[model samples]
Target: MSELLQFVFSGITVGAVYALVALGFTIIFNASGVVNFAQGEFVMLGGMITVFAHAAGLPLPLAALIAIVVTAAVGVALNRLAIEPARGAPVVSLIIITIGASIFIRGASQLIFDKQIHSFPAFSGDDPIHVLGATILMQSLWVIGGALAVFAGLWLFFTKTLLGRAVLATSNNRMAAQLVGINTKFVMTLSFALSAAIGAFGGVLVTPITLTAYDVGLALALKGFAAAMLGGMGNPKGALVGGLLLGLLEALTAGYLSSQYKDAAAFVIILAVLFFMPQGLFGRKSTDRV
Candidate 1:
């Protein structure tokens, strides 16, 4: 039972990170209908920049602020430079462009940050708190808290803010929003920035526990993309549920089954869900309008 609880705790931590990443994906997908593969680079940049900044004598909070802001800017730039240029391109072209952007970012990170795995001190000390026979790092609380806060913030933004409503309007119908005087281009840029900020924030919160390197983004991207798909493409609620479910599934696999295949659990469940539901747990059913 202790072992199970331990796995559950670990899974929730990792899942929170995944949730953040998935939320990032949903934002971009909804606003632009493009899957920004570079989404994970925001996380990588967050961790890498924070480590270097902290090493250079900046306080952790300040370093994290810089990382988040810079990453969000990069996301805006990506939309302007790459995605915007390729607007109206084929889906395959768009996919390739985003994938290329991801590769470019990874290569750049390696050059700028070195290939070393890096981490910094957790916000709270390394004390482990026990609950229900499971010991969890204080850092895990940060990750979970950060995820919940971001989700709540996003919920409020979409449901309450005029700018967020503009985003939603753009997502529902770009032409209609544009007709109503909404600046669709600005909405796209905002989506990218918001998504990247969320991803970077996750990176900042989790890096102390996960440690990070340039190459880690690919795996994170894959898992986050899977989680987004599992929940329902373009659905914020789906992203949250999908991330938690994927994480819990991985934990159970590690604890009760084979640790070696624990990583496979996410992909396997993704396939299973796709096989049956296709649209995903919370995804709306769609039909082509002939």
Candidate 2:
């Protein structure tokens, strides 16, 4: 039981990061029918920038805040410079553009930040806290708490805010939204900004545990994309559940199977889930908007 509980704790921590990534995917997908593969780079930028900022004598909290803002600006630039120009292009082309952007960001990061793995002081001390005979790190709690808080906050935003309603309206029908005086272009920009900010926050929370480097974004992006797909492509609630579930399964796999196979094991299960339920756990019909 102790061993099982430990695995669950580990899974939840990493799963929280994946959930953040999935949420990023969900937001961009909702706004622009295209998957932003570059989302992981935003997370990478968050951690990298925070590390460098802290190293340069800025307080850790301030560093993290800067990372988030900078990454958000980068996201906005991506939309304006790359996506907006290709507005009427095929979705596949837009996706390919994002892939190109990911490569560009990775290369740029290597030049700008070097190739060193980096991390910062955890929000809480590294001492493990014991619960039910299992030990959990303080940072893990931060990750899980941060993810849940963001989820709840997003739920409230989508339900209550006028801008949020405009997002929903645009997602439902861009033409109709514009007819009703909604700024569809602004909605797309907001989506990218929000998505990038979430990704950066996840990087800030998880960097103490996982460390960070210029090249870490690809795997994170793939895993996050898997989580989103597993849950239901455009559903926020589904993204949250899928991310946590994926994390749990990955933990269990690493514990019972082998850590070497952990990634493969988790992905294989996701494949099975997708094969059986193409629309995912919370997905509605194809016609339904986020």
Candidate 3:
């Protein structure tokens, strides 16, 4: 039982990170109808920027804030410089653009930050809290709490705020949203910025636990994509559920089976979602009639 609880704890911590990444994916996909593969780079930027800033004598909180803001600006720039110019292009082309952007960002980061793994001190101390005989890091609690708080914030934003409704309307139908005087372009830009900010925040929160490097974004992007697919793309609720579920599966596999196969769980989940549950847990089936 203790072993099982340990696995669960590990899974939830990792899952919270994946959940943040997945939410980023969801926001971009919903707003632009294009997946931003560079999403994970935002996470990398968050951690890397904070690490350097903190090292440069800035407080951790301020450093994190700067990272999030800078990442959001980068996201806005991505939209303006790349996505906007190719707005009417084929979806495949947009996806390829995002992939290229990811590679470009990764290379830039490697050059700027050097090829070294880095981490920051945990927000709390290094102490572990024991719950039901399973020890968990205090930072793990922060991560879980962060995920829930973000989820709640997003839920309220979508369900209550006027800007949120505009974003939703744009996501529902871009042409109609524009006709209704909703600034679809602004909505897309906002989506990217918000997504990037969220990803960066996750990176800041999780970096102490998971040391980061420039190349880490690729794996994170892949896993996040898997989680998004599992929960149903475009559904925030689905993103959260899928991320946690994927994390749990990975932890259990690593614990009971072999750590070697744990990463493969994301690939398997993606395949399973594609073949059987393509719509995902909270996603609705769609049909078009000619």
Candidate 4:
């Protein structure tokens, strides 16, 4: 039971990071109808930039703040330079574009930040807190708290704010939104910025635990994409549940089964879930009215 609790604790911590990644995916997908393969690059940029900044004598908090802002700007640039130009392209084209962008970012990061794995001090101390015979790190609490706060904040933004509604309107129908005087182009830009910011924040929070390098983004991106799919694409709530569930399952598998195949175990469960319910756990079915 103590061992089981330990796995659960670890799962929730990693799951929070996955949830953040899934949230990024859902935001971009809702806005542009395109899955951003480069979302993980934003995470990489966040951690890498913070590491560099902090190394250069800036405070850690300041470094993290700058990283989020810079990543957001990069996201905007990506939209303007790449996505906007190919506005009417096929989904395959967009996917290729994002993948290309991801590669570009990774290569750029390698040049800019080198290939070293880097981490910073935790927000609090490195001491572990005990819970029912299980130990949890202070940094893990920060990760989970960050995830919940982001979810809550986004929920409020979407439900209570005008600009948020405009974004939603644009997501529902870009043409109609434009007709209704919503700046859908701006909406798209905002979506990318917000998504990138979220991804960066996740990186900042988890770097202390996971340690990050230029090459870490690809695996994170894949896992995040999987979480989004498992939770029902384009749904924030689904992303949260899917991410946490994936983490828990992976931890359990690693604990009871084989650590080497833990990721494989998680994928198997995702495939099984998808097989029975194509729409995913929280996804709604849509049908056109005749």
Q: By lDDT, who's the top model here?
A: 3
lDDT of 4 by residue, 6-111 (tens): 9999999999999999999999999999899998898889999999999999999999999999999999999999999999999999999999999999999999
Total backbone collisions for each predicted model:
0, 0, 0, 0
TM for every model, in the order presented, reads: 0.98, 0.97, 0.98, 0.97
List the global CA lDDT of all models: 0.92, 0.93, 0.94, 0.93
Which has the higher lDDT value, candidate number 3 or candidate number 4?
3
- Candidate 1 lDDT over residue span 1-290, tens digit each: 88888988999999999989999999999999998888888999999999999999999999999999999999999999999998999999999998999999999999988989999999999999989888999999999999999999999999999999999999999999999999999999999999999999999999999999998888788889889989998899999999988888888898889999988987887788889988888999987768
User: What tens digits encode model 2's per-residue C-alpha lDDT throughout 134-191?
Assistant: 9999999999999999999999999999999999999888999999999999999999
Shift of residue 169 alpha carbon in model 4, Å: 0.8
Residue 160's lDDT in candidate 4: 100
Cα lDDT for residue 51, candidate 3: 95
C-alpha positional error of residue 117 in candidate 2 after TM-score superposition, expressed in Å: 0.9
